[model samples]
Target: MYVLGLGGSNHGFSACLLKDGHLESMIADERITRKKYGVGLGMRLAQGFSRNYCLDMEGICLEEVDKIVGNDLLVPTMYFRLQDKIQLINHHLAHAYSAYYPSGMDECAIIVMDGVGSKRKAGEEYEYESMTLYYAKNGKFDVIKKQYGYNLPGTDYVENSLGIFYAMITDIIGFGEHEEGKTMGLAPYGDKEFYEKIRKYIRYDNHANIEFNSSDIQEMLQLKEDVQAIKNQEEKERICQKIAWAGQQILEEIYVDIARYLQEETQCKNLCIAGGVALNSVANYKIHKKGFYDNIFITPASGDDGTAIGAAYYGYYH
Candidate 1:
C-alpha cells in the first residue's frame, strides 16, 4: 500500500509518501531547487528533483510505488511513466482532506480559503477558486460550497474574494506575494481608522454565507492615498500599520461570520481549516476564541505545501 502524493503544480511542489495509510516522508520542490513557489522556467526539472527525494525517503524506486495522487495541476510526465498510476482532485478538496484526516475527528466542518487556487471554467473562460466549505463523516468529505473570483471588468484584478482582498492590501502596503504574514503581524499596531471603509466592499451570500465578494475594488479600499510616496518616516510607518490593521479587522469579521454561519447550519462540533489564508494566526485565534466549535484543527502547512499530504490521503483512501 505505497501511495505517493504530489502537490504544488501552480506554486510550490511537494511530495508525500504513505505506507499503509501512514505518512512515510515528504519534501517540497522549493526545499531542494531553491526556487520560491516553483517560479520561473524548467518547473519539470524542479518537480523531478523533488520526486527523487521522496523516492529516496522510502528506499524505493518510482515503479515500486502502488499509486500516486496530485491536485488539479498537471504532473510532469518525466516523473511518472504510466499516467494510470496518478490521480488528481480539486485544489480545495485537497486542502480539506489535509485538515480533516489529521484532525483525528470522524466528522467535522472543513473550510479552505486562499488568495487564488486552481482555475475552473466559467462561461467562456476560467475563474479561480477563492473559498470553499466541506463536511466530513466516516473519513470522507464532500464539498458543500465553493466561491469563485470574477474579473472586475477591464481590469486584471479579480474581485469578490476575501483572501484576495487581504492579499491586495498586503501588496499595496509593499509586502507583496508571500509576505502576507507580515501584514497580519503588523495589524495589531494599527487602529480601526480604515476598517469601516474597507468593510463596505466585502460582502457575502449563499449557504453558510459562504459567497464572498468585493462589491467594488476599483477604489481598492480607497487606496488613493499611496503609502509608497510618503516621505515622512513616522507618517509612512503609521499609514502602513493602519492599513494592515483595517484589513485584518475586516478579514476576521467575515471569517467569523462564515464560521458562525456554518456552526449553526451543520451543527458540527469539530472544525478543520486549511489553505493559504488559514495561515493567519491572528484571524485563526479570533475564530477559536469565539467558541463556535468544540474542537478546531489547523494545519501548520496550510499552504500549497500541505496539499501534497491531502492528495496522498485522497489517493490512498480511495
Candidate 2:
C-alpha cells in the first residue's frame, strides 16, 4: 500500500510517502525553495504545477499540497495543491498515535495536549465536530474519548496557547523559544514564591480538566510588566526567574493532575504523551520522576510535524 502523509504547519509544510509501513521519501518545503518556512510559495507552486513538469516536493509543490488539504485546515500556504492519499488524522490524534504505536505497548494510557486543532460543532453545517483521541490494542484502533475545551467561547486557544505561554515566558526571560531548555535548567535556581501566585490561575477538577482563568494571568502579567521598571540587571534577572518559576510550577501541577486521573481511569502503567506541550522536557522529566507511570514514551517529533507520521500510521494500522 502506498500511503502519503502530509502536515500543514506554521513552521514548515512537510510530506511523507510511506510504502507498506516504511517511509519512502520525506522532505520539507524549505529545503528546495531556500526559504525558511515556504511562505506564499503554495500558490506560486500551484501555478507551476499547471505547466506539467516534474517538480521536487520541496520547492513550489508545497502550495499544491496545501490546496489539496484545503485552506481551512490551517495548512501552510506552500502546501495548497498536494494530494494526501492516506487517511488524514486530526492534529491531536496524529500526535497521540505517533506516541502510542511505536512504543509497542498493548495497553497504555495516552495523553495529547496541544495548542489547537481543527474545530467542529455538532448540528451545524457539518454532522459533527470534535477533538478526538484513539486507543489501540490487539491491532484495533477505536475512538476512546474526545475533548471540547478548545471550543469554549471567548478563549484565545490558538495565539495565547498554553504551549506558547511557556514559550513566551521563556522569551521574556531572555531565552529563545528553541532555547526553552534553558528555562528548565534555570528552574533549580528559583523558589516557589511565583509558584504560589500561579496556583490562583489554574484549578484542576475531578474530571482532570484544567480550568484557566484569564484574568489571573492578565493580573500576573501586569505585575511582571511593572517589575520590568527595575533598572538593575540583577533585579531584572530575579523578576524573570520568578515568572519562569510560575510557568514551570503550573505546567507540572496540571500534567500531574491529568496523569493521575488518566492512570486511575485507565489503570494502565505505560503512558504515551505528545503535543507541543510535550516539548517541555523539564515537565516531562518531572512526570517521569513522580512515577505517574511505570514507563513513559514521548514521540521524538512531538510537535505538529509528527502529525505526518501519525496520519500515515493511522491509515496503515486502522
Task: Report lDDT (CA) for all predictions.
Answer: 0.79, 0.59
lDDT of 2 at 164: 41
Q: How does model 1 score by TM-score?
A: 0.90
Q: What lDDT tens digits, residue by residue, belong to model 1 across residues 33-80?
A: 788876654636533766789889778998898888888754464345
The residue ranges of model 2 lying beyond 4 angstroms of the native Cα positions read 25-76, 83-87, 122-134, 139-146, 149-164, 171-179, 220-224
Measured with C-alpha atoms, the lDDT of residue 4 in candidate 1 is 88
Model 2 TM-score, 2 decimals: 0.75
**171: Cα error in model 1, Å:** 0.5
Candidate 2, residues 1-318, lDDT tens digits: the string is: 555565545554555555566655555555556655445575664442211222242333433431122112435443344344223446676667668777778877887876566556655422212223455566555655555433333433333245545655576577753566677677667777777665665565656555544454465456656666778999888777877788788777776677777777777788888777787887888789888689888887776656655665666665
Model 1 steric clash pairs = 160-213, 160-214
lDDT of 2 at 152: 32
Q: Alpha carbon lDDT of residue 72, candidate 1?
A: 79
Number of the top TM-score candidate: 1
